[model samples]
Target: MFQIFTSFFIIYGSKGGCPMTITKKLVPVIIACCLLFSLFLPSVQAQAAAKFSDVDPQRYGWAMDAISFMTDRGILNGYPDNTFKPGNSLTKAEFTAMLYRLFDKYRPNMQEEDADLRLAGYADVPETHWAHKEITAIYDYYFGGIAFAFKEGVEEPFFQPEKKLTRLELAQIMYMAIPFADDAPGASCQVIMGMTDIPYELFSSYEEADEYRFDGRYSEDTGISVDYYVSEGAPVLYPLVLVKESDGSCSSSFDDYSSIIESAVASMHTSGIMTADDSGYFRPHAPVSRAEAVTILNRTYNYLKANRNLQQYSSLETSSAAAGTPVTNPQPEPPAGKPSSTVNPAGNVKTFTRDLAVEGELETMIDTEGYRSITVSIEAKEKVDVIVQLGGKKSFIRHEELPQTIALNGIKQVSLETQKRVFDLLNRDADYTAVLTVELK
Candidate 1:
């Protein structure tokens, strides 16, 4: 275990009775005091103009930033009473409208009303509903492939437009919809609980949050342990926070849906997209208010916009539903019917050398079963961290492992989920050249 930094952001303030204390032993008290001093500075007033009485800029500074970002973009606004009810539960209809607003702002072409929307087929959401257009555009037209909100039934699909959105649902939806920067890789070996020669990457002594476990830790027959690389001067023990991992039992706090919501909660917490309560516990079952939802969306939109790249890799099967993956044209299905010849046909193996963008994706999609093999080779300039998706499964890879060949065995489908591509770049304008080859047998 390495001495990794804790994920929680310390709260500092004296407004609305917000806590001015640090209970977590790992959090340095000096840091909290510095934050307290910064709150009263004159420069912060501009950022604190969130205008919401309920959200104190000194206490919940991040909330203010989120609100300001959204309002400035004309995507969100305060209530008529001049109060942002940050704690009020958000309804499904409202969330849809918020997402549509973002879509309208970014994709101006989607602003027109496509009166021929096929949402009338949904049993619950009728065309006459107030949010029908917004819902149809995002749920039916934009995110039809992912369909995270749809509940399938025997007769037809249903959208619970009136139901309140929960924290778990919000986290899962945001993770699926927005692209976030990946955490930097930490040093491999460090001291864990004063134990020397301990590896940080692989840990078995205890779990951090049960719902979120990365590949760094694993279990052995003798006992649980960690595996990590040995880097000079890196922290040994990574901070492991307490999460629901002891028992697999579901909690009513999640309204009897704990099992399904657990992973999303952990992912959000770990990714810094969502934070825990004062007690450091993520209330997975709590309802997400409209203000909070807008804040999340605002943050997500900014992240996506900042990371957009003009260079993209196509021909690879990529999922439109993947977070932050731009969707323009729908994927065309392969022509029906197998090849007239029963022979196993070989595909054209072509090699091309091009500049790969830092945030770009290299994808290949195969619609014919005749192609059974794919080999890709690249001479990467840097250690680029990328995710490879085959069928529906995903695996993390680095550019260091390139100049290698990948053979698809007993694999019939390939789809790359478009999340953020992590790369070790020297600068913003940096581009790496990779030689790729694709062959089918």
Candidate 2:
């Protein structure tokens, strides 16, 4: 009918850039084509939308945009039954597949065979595994340069693909996937510590916990507390927090992996790629769910798209060494005519004295170039623990009394030393200060 042909032309002719004029001779052909298209339009739209039946808008309103963006682009797929098990724990293999698919969507030139070849070096990811190609591609593309050894002292390298991914692990992977800026600033340990929201119920002693709680008031077990050092409206730093020891020394809940995990979580949070739950908890050790993974990936993609100049991990030049391993480079001498404390011309030794006010912690980075030995003298009002990390080596200066001295030899740089937990119980605003004297010889 003429009406039907007119409706089809109005809907598709203008948009498709076809001639708008209708001719009597071509009407029969056009009508047949439009009839065929009408039969398939609803199915085509349904396939393109890819909406999951279980993803109710009311329950998953926060993740609706992310889910739609990923699924519509074919970056994520639901089960055969059309349900997305959003709450189920995501395995490492699943996460890897998702990441690889996302990368492929953006960088289509990457070949699957080349990615598969990269995984030949791994021990666990067999050729027949369902996600072997994806796992190989992600690992080789992002972490190829970093050395891997089994933490249990085994020589074989293993990729436990079936293991459930944890929040901390996800943060670390996301952090590594993006290349760091050349002038990226170092993350502060204190800031990372403050971002961790610890549940108040976990504290062993209520009397001891009263000092850190807000207004000295105890709430329900479900209540959480962000440490006093964290500013209001600041992002949560890490999912894990430092545990207070009975001996008054604070130790990381992550133990040996504490520093790296804290740094990764802090970087992700600061970059707006990952965040905490409604209760202000990162839940670092908890298993990452499918919905959370996609949401985070969506955020990462958006961030990368916004910052067009930033380079991805796949574009970086990698070496055999670990990602953060410090490389010693030649340094230029300090400019002449600069003031130095007690400079000796014969030995070229200079002593620098600084008085630092320690609230939560104080971090200092000292260049140890053109020097043989360095000595640090500390004088504090109260007992404090000074942690010195240089060239991957950590030394401690626990001031049981006061006025202690420590010496370092053959060090290219002293990266960070933090003086922690000098609480002024009587006056909260008071500063517990320390005097640090560094002598470079």
Model 2 misplaced regions, further than 4 Å: 1-50, 105-120, 140-154, 180-187, 196-256, 309-441
Show where candidate 1 strays beyond 4 Å.
1-50, 105-121, 140-154, 179-263, 277-280, 309-441
Worst 10 residues of 1 by lDDT: 184-193
Writing each residue's lDDT as its tens digit, candidate 1 over 42-67 gives: 44324445466676666556566566
Query: By TM-score, how accurate is candidate 2?
Result: 0.45
Best-fitting candidate, scored by lDDT: 2
Query: Which candidate's TM-score is highest?
Result: 2
Q: How far out, in Å, is residue 375 in model 1?
A: 6.7
lDDT of 2 by residue, 1-441 (tens): 457777777667774675577678668888787787677664422432355777766576656666765676666778898887777898888888888777654232143233322334456667899987776556532232121222234433566678787787788776555532111122223335455453222234434443444341212331212222212242333333344434332323222123345556666665566666555576776888877887887766655444442234233212222111122212212223323212343453333333333123444455665676666666666544565555333444555523343355665555334443322222444345666556666
* TM-score of candidate 1 against the unseen true structure: 0.42
Error of 2 at 298 (Å): 0.8
